[model samples]
Target: MPSLRSIRSRIRSVKNTRQITKAMEMVASAKMRKAQQRVLDTRPYAEKIYELMHRIASREKAWSSPFFETRPVQTIGVLLVSTDRGLCGAINANLFRSLVRFMKERPGVRFEFVTIGRKGRDFIRRSGFNLTGVIQGVKDRGTIEEILPATQLVIEEFSEKKNWQEAWIFYTQFESIMSQKPRHEKLLPIDPEVLTGSGNPPNGHSGEYLYEPDRRDILDVLIPRYFETVIFQRVLENFASEYSARMVAMKNATANAKEVIYGLTLTYNKLRQANITKEISEISSGAEAISQG
Candidate 1:
């Protein structure tokens, strides 16, 4: 059994840790609320752009954009997004696991990865994956311009490289506070169905509209903008998912800390009682010895 002084010191240390975890839990809760609101506000716009893009692609037979052009797969580009910090539970691990599975399946094809956070970059580097670009410190509220440089570079690299056929983005999709799932989505050769969210054509809107500035001309600008929208929404969604995961993880940590403190308190009390009982017995024995003498 440990001494009373040692138990007291341990109890104090655990209490301090509990306090820190509580603080982190509160901070994560506050951030999650803000992030959730931003995600809700942006979803409609992203959905609409996706719908419109899909509609355009489906309506015109000859109308085509480079983004919609599907070619043979040789070299692939993967944009992996994850948080810089841990303690957000399995968010980064889940992403890395998915990436590992994806790379494993396509062993013959070369992979050029673009990592959007410190965790993702460190992961691929440590695993000896070919990293093409690294973007770190992306703000919780990132702008299109912030991601534009990286997006352009990926596009340019794909255009310049003959073997590179497609680009994919692996990220966590935020469904609810309790449910964030790692998703594998193609970022290049933009699938019209993917943008619209409805892989099938909506019967009501298919034949109603006529093109204004020629279908090809409109697609030239819309396709790239559509791609940008996808990237923007993804970053926002990624931020919201991070907050939600962190909030849940911290809450669990705080609960676990409380449990630890409770167990320690019980032990401390038991130890103190034992010490007091031993002292009383010793005192009584001394008195009895003196009385007997």
Candidate 2:
């Protein structure tokens, strides 16, 4: 058994750790609330844009946008979004695991990756994947400009640079404080059903939307904005998921530290009482002996 003094020191250490975890928990909670709100506020607009893009995509050759051009997917672009730091429970680990599964599912398919955080960049490097672009230090509330590099990489791959035929983005989606879902969302060569959250088209000829000037004109204007909206919403969703995971992780840590402190304090108290009782017993014995003498 450890000495009482040593146990006291351990109790103090655990208390300090608990304090730190408690503070971090509070910070993560605050950030999670803001991030969740941003996601909720922007998701509808992003979804509508997604639905509109898919609707236009149904026009096929009738629509003149290069983004609508379909080709054999010789190369695929992947935009992997993850947090720069850890302490977020299994959030990043689960994402990385899913990414591995995605890669495994497409054995021969060459991938060009654009990473939006330090963790993703590291994974790309370690996994020996081609790193097309990297976006680091993005805030919880990232602006369109800040996320342009990533979206641009996807556009460049399929259009400007013309290296890849299709693109997808992977990120954890915030469902609730306790549930963050990792999603693999196709970004380009638009999957109509996926875009609109519909499992399948109702018929061979899907319903259409009317345009003011023409389909070409509207798509030309909306295509770039669609890219921006998709990327922005992904980033917001990523932020919210990251913060929620972190808050929950920190809360669990604080709770665990508290349990450790309680156990240590209990041990310390028991040992101290034993030592005090031993000293009193020894002193009393000595007094009785002295009186007898």
Candidate 3:
């Protein structure tokens, strides 16, 4: 058993830690609510754009868009999305693991990375993976205009340089407060079935489609918008995932700190009681001895 002073010190330290974790938890919760709302607001737009793109890509008529083109796999581009800061549980770890597995599955393909967050950039740089591009300091709830440069970089890398045949993005999907799943998705050549999912609504029929200038002109506009929308949606989702994971992690830390304080308090009480009992016994013994003397 330790001294009362030592136990009290530990209790005080833990109390301070608990207070810090509790405050962090509250901040994360507030950020999570905003991120969640943004995600929900954009889902409809994302789904519709994906549906429209899927219908066009799935047709046998054969669109000549480079985005839909399938080429020989020699080089692979990866867009790794991670939080700029830590204390977000294993959200980024899950993404890294998925990327590792993907690399293992496809041996001999040269992989280059475009990292959105500082963490991903550091990881890629440290791991000796070729870093083609990096865009950091992307704010939460960032606008499409702000995110467009990174999108353009990836697109140009694929189209202009033709260095990468296929590209994928890794992010954590915010399913719920307690549940965030790491998502690994192919960004290009776009997968048709993934876009359509279970198919579109009744109004999504080809007959309802109308071209303002021409079909080709519509596609030219739609393709870039598709990329922008998808990237923006993922960014928002990662924000929600980051905050949710942080909130849960901080909540756990606070709870564990409280438990530690409770245990220490219990031990301190026992030790103090034992000391008081010993003092009373000593006093009683002394009184009896003096009386006898």
Note each model's CA RMSD in angstroms: 2.3, 2.2, 2.4
- Model 3 vs. true fold: TM: 0.92
Task: Give Cα-based local distance difference scores for all models.
Answer: 0.78, 0.85, 0.87
- 2-97 per-residue lDDT for model 2 (tens digits): 987788888888889989989998999999999999999999999888877786676554655557777787799999999898888898889989
Residue pairs whose backbone atoms clash in candidate 3? none
User: For residues 157-272, could you state the per-residue lDDT of candidate 3 as single tens digits?
Assistant: 89888988998888889899999998878888876666456544334455335668987898789888988998889888999999999999999999999999999999999999
Query: Each prediction's TM-score against the native?
Result: 0.91, 0.92, 0.92
Looking at candidate 3, the ten consecutive residues that score lowest on lDDT are 199-208
Model 2 stretches with alpha carbons more than 4 Å out: 61-65, 193-197, 200-210, 291-293
10 residues in a row with least lDDT, candidate 1 = 199-208
Which candidate model has the greater TM-score, 1 or 2?
2
Runs of candidate 1 with Cα error greater than 4 angstroms are 60-64, 160-163, 192-199, 202-209
Judging by TM-score against the true structure, name the best candidate: 2
Clash count, candidate 2: 0
* Rank ordering of all candidates by lDDT, starting from the highest: 3, 2, 1
